[model samples]
Target: MDIKKGYIFPKPFWSSLIDVNIRGLQEECYEIRNNVPSKYKSNLGQNSYHSPNLLNLQNPPEILKLMKQITNCIQTIHQQSRRENVRLVDFWININGKGGSNVPHTHPGAKYSGVFYIKVPKEMKRGNLFFLRDYNETYLTSQENMGFFKQGYNLLPYDLPKIPVKPLEKLLIVFPSWSPHSVELNDTDEERISLSFNYILFR
Candidate 1:
């Protein structure tokens, strides 16, 4: 169990499981912006759909089945880390359409969190998930100085070293729960489907 700080678990493929879970989810819930007030209506407003927590779903059997598969995957990761005491919070599916995007945020009080991209539409121009660097807050402020400062004098955030999005099929991206991350807006006209979940590690 040698987990390094900021360690990323390699992407895992669970096509069959994903298919089953997504099928059930699609039938069960409609897409809504994550964390937005009920009165809000706009794709640009913190865009992302969150399914009800799996445990609270009206159809518990289907939700339970999906939970089992998700937990099994988490168990496998824990086994590899030789860490057995991992407890998963319920999972949520995120459905995004053209112009939809998620704001930067972290999962509070969880050890690790991850997303599984089930369906990535071909039309998407910039729908990749992005992880924020430790300096993002300062970097964003620096962007304002670009107009007044000469080239190279103004620090552009992207010019600084950045971790690139690692591509994979049916990608499962795992990171510390508190890591800031976001999904770039889907500029193209198509839907993006994904699921995110959290887990706590106990000794």
Candidate 2:
């Protein structure tokens, strides 16, 4: 007799490429950060410098290309047809200085959201992206098997909860807007620059 036990859920997926023009992107990011008015600056969290309008920057072809690739990957995974329309509603850059970190939160009114790591220090001391699993059967099941089984992609450990994302250069991660995520404290002296955006689906 044969039987199968399974698991299913929408988890954040990411892709990376080492060839993207990082220096160019960084230059543009710096310019935007410097030129934007103080009214547009946000210090609500630990962000040292947040660009007012990332996608609105003039002649921002690199960012646009990255956004297109991200959306294409998202649509492809869901098997959405080429004709289905999806558009990015907003995007911004976050420059996290030392001691900067974000509290756990979810995007309230968007179908999909994501982040792209533009610049990360060579030797990162603390800054990292951590994702939390929402309370569900998986959480309960993982708890039950805490000490017995090891956590692998195939066999998950029940006790293991938050997953940390490696913020490598030119890495992009996409996920459902409702997923809860947070940033670890940036203990390093260098700044951590990244772009965050939200998307919506249209008929």
Q: Write the per-residue lDDT of candidate 2 for residues 1-203, one digit (tens) a residue.
A: 89997766546455656356888888877877788752233333444776665566564777777777777766764455345556787888888888777777888898778788999988796778878766674466564654455455464443357778878888888777888888887777888889888887787
Best by TM-score: 2
Q: For residues 1-203, what per-residue lDDT tens digits would candidate 1 score against the true structure?
A: 99775534433322222446555554443433333223222224344555555545444454456556766777776677585577887666666766777776778898767777666776555776777755654466353643345556765444343334532335666777777777778776666777678888767
Q: List the residue pairs that clash in candidate 1.
A: none
Error of 2 at 64 (Å): 3.4
TM-score of each: 0.63, 0.77
- What's the true lDDT of residue 184 in model 2? 84
Report lDDT (CA) for all predictions. 0.60, 0.73
The candidate maximizing lDDT is: 2
